[model samples]
Structures are given as C-alpha cells and as structure tokens.
Target chain A: MKLLSIKFTNIEEEWKYEKIELFDLTLLVGVSGVGKTQILKSIHTLKEIAGGQSVNGIKWELEFQTLKGNKYLWLGEFETINSANELNPEFFIELGDLKEPKIISEQIFLNDKIIIDRNSEKFQFNGNEMPKLNSTESAIHILKEEHLIKDIYENFNLIILRDHTFKIVDLFDLNQYRIEKLKNQFKTFEEIKKSDLNTFHKLVLIYDVSKSAFEEIKSRFIEVFPQVENIRVAHNVINEHSNFDLETSLIQIKEKNVQKWIPHHKMSSGMFRTLLHTAEMYLWNEGTVILIDEFENGLGLNCIDVLTEDLIYENNKIQFIATSHHPYIINKIPYDYWKIVTRKGGIIKAFDAKDFDLGKSHHDRFMNLINHPFYKQGIS
Target chain B: MNLYFILKGEKTEVLLYPKWINYIIPHYKQVFLEKDVIENNFYIFSGGGIPSIYNHTINAIKNINDNPVFDKLIVCLDGEDIGIEERLQEIKKHIENSKVVLNPKCKIEFVIQNICIETWFLGNRKIVKKVPEGLMLREFIAHYNVNTNDPEELKKI
Candidate 1:
C-alpha cells in the first residue's frame, strides 16, 4: 500500500498536523523537533488500530492506494472518556481509575463509493444497517474477512517500520531446528525459488539456493566495503567445548589477504548494516512500504553513496519514507522528493521543496536551502 | 568559454553569485563541482574570507594552469577597509610571492565589490517598497537611501 496523503489531529492535546502529501520516495528534511518522526508514528498507530488496537483522542484521515490500483479514503476519530466518570462502578471502585477510548465515527470510501459508514447511533455496511457491530475496533478489522475488505486489510500488513539503530536478530538467528526445517521444506533450488518465504528465511538459504543471487549481493556489498574479499552463510559449531553438539549458521566474511573469516557478530556495526540493507533490498517482497527513521545513523561515506544510489536507481517497486539530517543525503536526493517539515507550538506543517522555488536555478541547492527562511526558522 | 570563479564571503556569495550569473548569463550552466565542468559551464569555489581568499586565488590559478579547459578566471571579493586598487595589488603580490605561473591561454579578471556585496544586493530598488513596513528596513533606507543613490558610494556607519 502507498499512502498518498494524511491529516492527523490529537484533539485532547490540541496538536494538529496539517495534511501532507506523499510520494513514492519521500524524504522528510527539517530541523529537530519539527514532528517528522511523529508523522511516521501516527501512520504506525493507524496501522495498529487497523489491526484491532484501541487508541485515544486521535482524529485521522488517510488516503492510500492498494497494490491492485484500488484507492481508499479512510477517516475516523477515537472517543476519549474521563477516567473518574466513565468507568464501570465496580471496576472503578477496584481500580480507582480507568479510561477507555473506542472508535466513535468511521467512514470508508472505495473509488468514491461508500463501502462502510458508522456513527455513534448508526452502523451501516454497503448501505445496510447493522446495530450489533463492535465499536472498539475499526470497520476494516471487523469486516476483514469480506472479499472487498481483505485486500485493504492485507495492505496494512505490508507497511513495515524499519529502525536502523535496532538490529533485527531474527535475520541472523539461525538455529538447528530452523535450519533443518528449511532444508526439508525446499530440497531443490527450484522449489526454494517457487516458495513464498519471508526475507529472513530467503536470505538464510540465498547462497545455497542461487549462487548468482548471492554473488550479486556480494558485489553490491563489496562496492561499499572493498576490504571484504568473500562472504558466505554456513554452519558453524558454537559449542566446541560442550559434549552436546550446538551449531548455527552464521554469515561470515573474509578480508583481503587474510586467512580468518569474520562472523556476523564480530563484524563492525556499519559493515553489518550495509550488508543487511543490501540483502533486504534484493530479497524484500514487492509492493512494500518501508518507513525508516534517521537513515544515516551508522552509515559511512561509501555506504551512504551506495545506498542512496540504490534507492534512486534500483527498479524495485518498494516505496521508502525516510528522515535524514545528513547534508550529503539531502543534496543527493532530488529536491522534488523532499518535504520540508516545520512546526510552531501545536501546529505542524510540511511543504514541498518546489514551493520554495528550489532547484529552479543552477545554484548550490543545499546552500540555498540552508539559507532559506523556512528552513532556518523551521516555520512557514 | 568555460569560466572559473573564486569567491569571498563563504556563505552569501557562494549562494547568491550563481543566481545572479544565471540571471545575467542564462545560457551558461553553473557546475557545482569542478569535475562536472564542460564548455559554456561555470564553476565556483568559496575562498572562505579575506586574507585566506588571497591564497585561495593563487591555488585556483595553479589549478587553472594544470587544467587548461578553463578559458577565464574571475576572482570576486569585497573591497572592505581598503581601496579597490590596494585590494587588487594585495592579490597580485600574493600571486607573485607564490611563484605560480598563470595559463597563457586563460585570462584572469577581478571584480571588487565596493564596501561589500550586501550593499550591491541592497541596490535593487524593486525589493524594498516605497513605504516600508518594517522598522529596521525603514531605518536602513533612511540612513543610506540606496533607492536613489549608488550603494557602492554609501559610507560605512
């Protein structure tokens, strides 16, 4: 699913973010405390609510396009209740405090036709009244099994949040049982290629399943870190001193003119991050929207250049919404893909780079951007 | 002709010159880096500021001598706290002390912005309104009146 635009407001807190448009590759650029990460968090919160979680006092309107070219406009608000007044008398006596927020109003439109509409007094699906529907969950979650709603619900599953600072242990956690299951499930390379496996599982067997794919990832990794001579994923015995056998598959890399192979845990964070990102880009499923925060945290100069080039030049159908304060990243990305965020008190806004007439002249665009009043003051 | 520029005032001139260049010479494209230069392209390098700009100019001359692709070199700096002739002589003396030879095919030129480049910017009459709203801008206009006089001749307060 691709988010086209969003308008979010927290009524209780009096904080509101103006409607911001999104592109396939949107990069949020601004000074700190401008609510760039809050925008991403709001989207994740909506995803959680779509998965049947209750959150309070947030009014949101999201317009997204599904993989099958179906456009949807979903808007709703969660009702917030006072803890002392709204709780059940018995529960209030025991707990002393309780506050609950539930979905109070929801409207879903598909291609401009109303698929579901619900209010405090009325609940309707396809213009049919149903008074027995639940208010604690989103209509999309309640009707997820319906044929029309299944794709929309599944699209929320494709929104993946990637934090570069946190390592995903599952990608490198290769135990004996998991390895054995993978081996038994796909005995041949063709079967491995035909199976619908996740990125972590596919990556664990990449070298064995397809040599060319492994070589491609290796070459890309080498472009960023030239010291790496070779890389492989193989079974390595962890408990050599123990009587009972304990083994796991670890990603190992050999340096130029060196006999020792460095395992994944022993490698530097920057090197490991570059390798993981390279592999994920190659193996991630199509039609996926990846949200990344602080994109340049652990990246070196060479890694930044290679990754930025891959993001711009690669033909993968993945959409990226990333935030960065690095000047190299800001200058490297085209100005048209930038959304300059600014804030004042409870109001936040995002403006397109084109609105400031950036990139229209052949000047130093980065220098011009830094000197701009909107960027300097962080308000427009 | 491919032109190379070494500018003073690390921040403002580095930003404003290309815009003015593009406005005056719309046909010539500005190259951000020297390696991207081609025919009819201009590239700029900031010298950081005054005394350092003299050495930067000599370094740029050495680079231009080694790469003969550039046909012209323009050194732009403020004529601050000194006469325009003295600033020009100071730059020449630096070049002579460095013992660097200029490329015979490429011509060298200097543009000394009198007082400062910001004064030149203020000379644009269209930017400020006749009846200004801001107090600081109104006071600045009343002190020098750039709208009616040559801003370069305005005295420092």
Candidate 2:
C-alpha cells in the first residue's frame, strides 16, 4: 500500500505545517540544518502512536489514509505528555463505508439476527439525536461477531503498515539474539530455546529447511571484513525493559581491510558512514522508516555523485527522511522531495522546495541559493 | 609545463593552462560526457567525468607531467607540525617518476623562506608562539598558510 499524504503539527522547524507527497522513490534534499530528518521523526512518531505505543510530550494532531477506505484519527488531551499518568484523550478508527459497522440498527446480534441496536453508545448519522450506547452491549464487538471487519487490529496497526510497506519487514531483519529474546518472552523457555544444542538438534530436522530461508535472506546483505572476516552489526543492544529500547539498528564493515595495527576511530569518516547507508538499505528491504540526523557526516566532495546515484537513486523500497548540510546528498534528490526548514522565532517551519518556485525542479537552483543563504541576521 | 591545480571547490572556471598535454581527470567535474573522454597525457584528480569539456587543470597536466620543464617539483605545505611532503610522497612519486622534496627556492618557490622570516618576525604574537631560532626555512613554510591549489596564493620570493 502507498501513502497518499501526511498532515503534521507541533514538530521541528522543518516539519510544522508539513504537507508532504510521496513518490515510488522519494528523495529528501537540502544542506545541513534544513530539517529533513525532523519530518521523518514526526512520521515515525505518528506511526508509533497509532500502534498503541506512545511517547511523551508529543502534543499535536496528525492523520493518514490507507489504500483501504479507512481513515484513522488519533486525538488526545494529556495531563502530562511524559509521565506514566499521561491519559489518552481519544482513540478510534473509522472503518470504510462498510454498512452497519456497529450493530446499532435497533438491534444487538443474537446468534444471527439483531436483538436491539437501541441504547448504543453515541449514535450519529444523517442527524440522529444523541443516544446512550448500552454499557453491557458493545456495538463494536457485535460488528466483530458478524465478521464486519476481518483484520481490524492488524489493519489499524500503524507500526505494521510502516514496517511492512514503508519500512519493509521487521522479522527478516532480526538476528539470532533478537530472535531468542522474542522467543524467551514467550514464558516457556524449554520450548523456544534455539541456542541449546538439544533443542536445536531436533528443531533443526523439523524446521531447519525454513530456517535456511531466513538465513539466506539475512546473509545476502551482510558485508564480510577481509582482516578477520568477522561480521559486526551496528545496533546497540537495547534492553526492552529500559526506557529507550529499539528492535532494529544499522551495521558497518571496513571500506578497506588489511592486517595492520589500526585504531578503530582512525578510518576515514566518510567511508565509515557507508555502514549506516547499508544497514538502512536492509531495513528498507524490511520496510522501516529511517530518520537519519546527519546524512553527510564524514563524506567528501569526491564521493558525492556516486552517493547520489548508488544510494539515493538506487534504493526504491525504504522511505528516508534525513537532514544534511552537504550538497552532495541534497542535489541528487529532486526539489519536490527536498524540504526547506527555516527557524522563525522559536518555531520550525518546513516547506517544499518547489513551493518557493514555479514550474521547474528545485534541485540545482535551490542548491545554488539556499546552499548558503545570507540570513536576515548579519552573522552566518 | 603540465601544471595541475587540485582545487578545493564546487565552482566552475575556464582553463588558464596549455592544451597539448594529456589530462587524467578526477570525478566531480560537473560536466557531461563527450567523445575522447580518457586522455593518456593528462592525469587529473578532479576530472569532470566528461571528455569533451575544457578544464584548466586537465590541460595543464597533459604531456608536461613527464617533461622536465619544472626542473624541480617544490612542495609547499602548512606548518601544523604535520609532515606534509612525507604524506604526499606516494602521490607525488606516482605522478612523476622523481623523488619529491620540500626545499627553499627564492623565486617562485620563495613561499617557504618567506614563511621562515614571517614566523621569526611575528612569532610570540598573541596566540602565536615563536619557533626555535634558526628553524630552517623549509620547515618554516609549514607555519604559513599555503594554498594547495592556487599557486598565486603562494608567497612569491
């Protein structure tokens, strides 16, 4: 499924009043401090909230449409955005114009026929007066009994949509450690322990074939270092119980490896960032929305053109919302995808590059002018 | 002379060098491709990727890269206490089949000796500390700002 458009409010300078369109392959362009990453962060926030997960201090209104005729609206008034005492003001999704979404046609279902739709919670349509919904009778549950919405929860899962369609897939991206952690959370450790030889031996015979398929997909993207040929992933080990836990992360390998005493930090900064791009591509394969804060950290002008042609233009699956001050990454993508985020007062304002211009794409012209804007302030 | 300028830039300029030499262009030249793109005579670190486009550095380094017009290739570098010529040795020797050295030449190469005098004249100023007395002129060149690409920026002795 494709995303049509997004409405964002109360976000970073580049994301406020953000109305962004998507392409089969969208390129976010701009130099550093322009706020491309902020847009990505906001969208990821909205998707996370939709999945019944919430982050504090995220005060605002946002909405999105799916290929299915479902319009999900999330609105809330929290006492405090950060603390656990934070309350959800409202949560509901409008299913497609599927008739009788709730069993309120003057009947609640009994086996098959509707017994009563009366006393349903807050009825409104074509101007019907407010009526109390029966406390004992949940109209939503009645609709579910009739198979009105088959995949209700799965369809409403914002994370699943972001991961499956936009981010790609999450299951394939998980390694052995994550796989075991998810299994251990099952409570029955004896049944789920894959690392144990006894468990692995029998399971290997039964599901070893399917396991190979998973490994085959995982192995395709891994880069092997020539020195020790050791494979290293970049994601930090996150404790789920901890306040900041993430399921996926990026990985990197040396650009050129040989046997020599070398400090880990001494590698060229530009080549080191290649690891981030590679891991990001893998997540794109799994459908993950990546928000890169600085896209041009260690890069030089020498590798600019290849970075555009190879990374930005080549990858089609993942959605990248990154902020960069370097023209190398920005010029590769089109102006429509490039957003200009300017900070006015204390608020952030994000705009499409093309909005500031007519007809032509903003790639070259914006790069020339905005690449170095002589700000209203005297000092750069 | 096959003269090349390894410019640090994103801007474009016209060639102020000769045309007979072969030019090996580096990437990021900002020009589109044309015929006769690869040249054996010129080795350019910043090729615009297109063969037909004219480049000052590309034309300068052509044919003359091997000729003896330069007499000696004098290396100018910053005095950040970092060994500049030592780092450039591999690259320099690879380009021209001669050993590269950092030395004093009073005419066009006087930038080094000038740096020597400048350090003795202005050292111990505010944040700048003076180098050891008689810190050979070649070593003093490291104390001055030397433009890697623009020869005109060099202190003309």
* Candidate number with greatest lDDT: 1
Error of 2 at A301 (Å): 8.2
Highest-TM-score candidate = 1
Off by over 4 Å in 2: A1-3, A11-18, A22-37, A53-63, A67-288, A297-317, A358-366, A371-380, B1-157
Question: Candidate 2 lDDT, tens digit per residue, B14-90?
Answer: 13111212243332222111111233222122223112111322232332233323222222222222234443443
- Per-prediction DockQ comes to 0.04, 0.03
Tens-digit lDDT string for candidate 2 (A96-177): 5212222222322222333333433444321344355433323333233334322222333322211212221221233443
Q: Count the backbone clashes (under 3 Å) in each candidate.
A: 0, 41
Question: Which ten contiguous residues of candidate 2 chain A have the minimum total lDDT?
Answer: A160-169
Q: Quote model 1's TM-score.
A: 0.68
Pairs that collide in candidate 1 are: none
**lDDT per residue, candidate 1, A1-380, as tens digits?**
88999999987667889999988889998989888898888888888888888787889999999989999999999996544444345344554344457788999999999988998888898888977777889988999998988999988887878776566455544454467678788766556544556554566687777788889989989888888989988875566677755556778999998899998878888888888789878776667788888889889888899888877768347888889988788789888899999999889999998776543323345545654456767853
Please state the error at residue B127 of candidate 1 in Å.
35
lDDT of prediction 2: 0.36
Candidate lDDT values, in order:
0.80, 0.36
